[model samples]
Target: MESDLRIAGTNSRPDIVAWAASEDGKVVPWVVIEIKSGASSSKPEFVLPQVAQYASTLGTADNYVVMGTKWFKADRSFRRLEPVSGPTPPPFGSHGEVDDPAVVEPLLTNWLASLTREMAPRELPVGLPTLEGFSVTNEAYWRAAMRAIADTTSRSGFAQHSSSPLIAALVARLIGNRLEGLVLDPFSGVGSFLWAVADRVRGAMERGESPPNVRLLGVELEERTAAIARAIGEIAGVPTDIVAGDAFRVELPMSSAIVTAPPVGMRLPQPYELLNGRVTTDMDLAAVDLSLRHLEEGGRAVILLPRSFVYRSSGDAYREYLANEFRVGALIGTPRGAVPGTSFAGVVLVIDKGDAPGETFVGQAADDDWQVQLGVEGALTKAAVDHLDGFSEIWS
Candidate 1:
């Protein structure tokens, strides 16, 4: 909490912060509430931009959200608005009128909390009967699998990554709804995307629901990540065919719903021999090209890459390629210092396979309140609820 405020330059002596947690004692990523008195702006005038700056600082600038006070009816009904564009001006409140924290405090907090509330088991997908159903089904099983994988691997300097809960669920829901399912993670660092998808499958089974056939695949040149991914799949009771190869050279499965996280010029030790492949000293355009190719006709994909890819002149050709092959659904830009310990700016691009596009939903997920980010964009946040939904089926 303190670090985030410091990074945003919002830390102030008058600001009293409190930690937030779930009933189960898990630290709610929502972090703390900031209560202050006698500030000239009531709510900090810079708060919205500061939050936007914080988004950029956290590499989630594309997802900008500012929750503040609002008028409430006797029954506590109120309105919450997702900031579409521009900085949220001072005197924050619903309907662009009142700014007093006294009026705004309870309402804002409630609104934020509502956005972070977890789903009840009844609201989740029905449970499956056995390990034959899917790779992941419940929180209990997923944790157990993660722990087992962690146990097998050495602790030192190993990095594991996965798709955010939102991404995972979106794919599952798409599949459940009878849309063709094809997932490709170009920057399959640690197979987070695959795990998320597996978890979604598990959720559907638990809910007594089944999805149409789907294929989950990723490219990780590093052996360590690929090995751990395979092991995780085994532990989760699902069979995953994650190959050890460069994303550019690996053949991607067809369809759409591509979700990936590419490296942002971060120099990390790769655990593979660069055999007969072009090893570039910088970001690989070939990898991006491969991503563009893998999307099936009329499919949509989201890619998480460095912010420079959004505006840099060098990436113009890539952007142009995307424009031709896929409709540019959305472009979210982030500020510097977004990812902790890394200088790269983060951005999420939503793209469709062809000229026609679906409604674009974009929002930043800061360490401050990830659940809210998910709730505010519920349409795009499927992975978060997959576990509760249960796994209905799995293909080996």
Candidate 2:
């Protein structure tokens, strides 16, 4: 139940701060836990440095770092760090391991639970209304739940879907700092894009810097989905307006930056005005066109579209329109199944409204390592920018 414990008299917040009770009923710090997400660096060598730093601050040699199913001890004797897999008890060599099996099991369980809660909030903040009455308050959990719902709904061929969290974060980083005024996600789905924006702002604040001035606007056609998006925005403490309506028909202000993964292969009831009333069936084009219409001059858009939208013969007009009207900044190809439970390989298209580029940068992501590829420090580096393709154009 020490999930909410904070390090006393210090700004540093370790992932989990375990405590043990003494004979006099005085509580004492037992272990410092640092949990890394699956997307993060799980290798002991990569994480132990930071764990060592935290241990130094806590003045405890009983420090541990948990990454996915792996755990490592941070101490002078920290050598040959190997991750212990499965839900079973920690091995004997684990840092701060207790002698009794009964005593250690509950401690490890509580620590894991604490890690989960830290990563995703356990309880929903009071007074927020949700579409589904489910009480799970974790952002990552809800995103997966929404994706599963989309999979079931996709059976009817009504919804396409949003990007996975990894993809969404990558798209947001590609749009980095260019986001100004209102940020729009026309097909918000479960608000992955919006949450990415909030996470960026939150990350900046956490680093003791001023958060960028940006507002989020998400339009989801389904009311239930919109409610979930709204709840996510609230939980993340981001100012967002989630509208339940068709994005094509919804009246919205022009945005400085737009980021979204619009549903593909869906037919719209009516063609968007931005498409000049010529194309109505292709939702992908409609999405691109809608983003173009709402995006202000000098503003930018980072959109996720099916790879066919770029090279397929049927999408020639869309490609031509994109080339003529917008400057192609970068096109990043993602591996198949990056979205999970789907075979739709995708491309991240960075479009600028002012001038069309003579040459566009194109690259394919080798894997879904967003933590390093999209990390605040890691993603913004010159080499990372160049690796993203179109670094010269984007920075120039």
TM-score per model over all chains: 0.49, 0.59
lDDT of 2: 0.62
The CA lDDT of each predicted structure is 0.45, 0.62
Q: For model 1, what is the error of residue 226's alpha carbon versus the real structure, in angstroms, after optimal superposition?
A: 0.9
Model 1 over residues 116-141: C-alpha lDDT tens digits? 23432223322211222122223544
**How many backbone clashes can be found in candidate 2?**
0
lDDT of each residue in 86-110, candidate 2, tens digit only: 2233233223312222222333233
Deviation (Å) of 206 in candidate 2: 1.3
List of clashing residue pairs for candidate 2: none
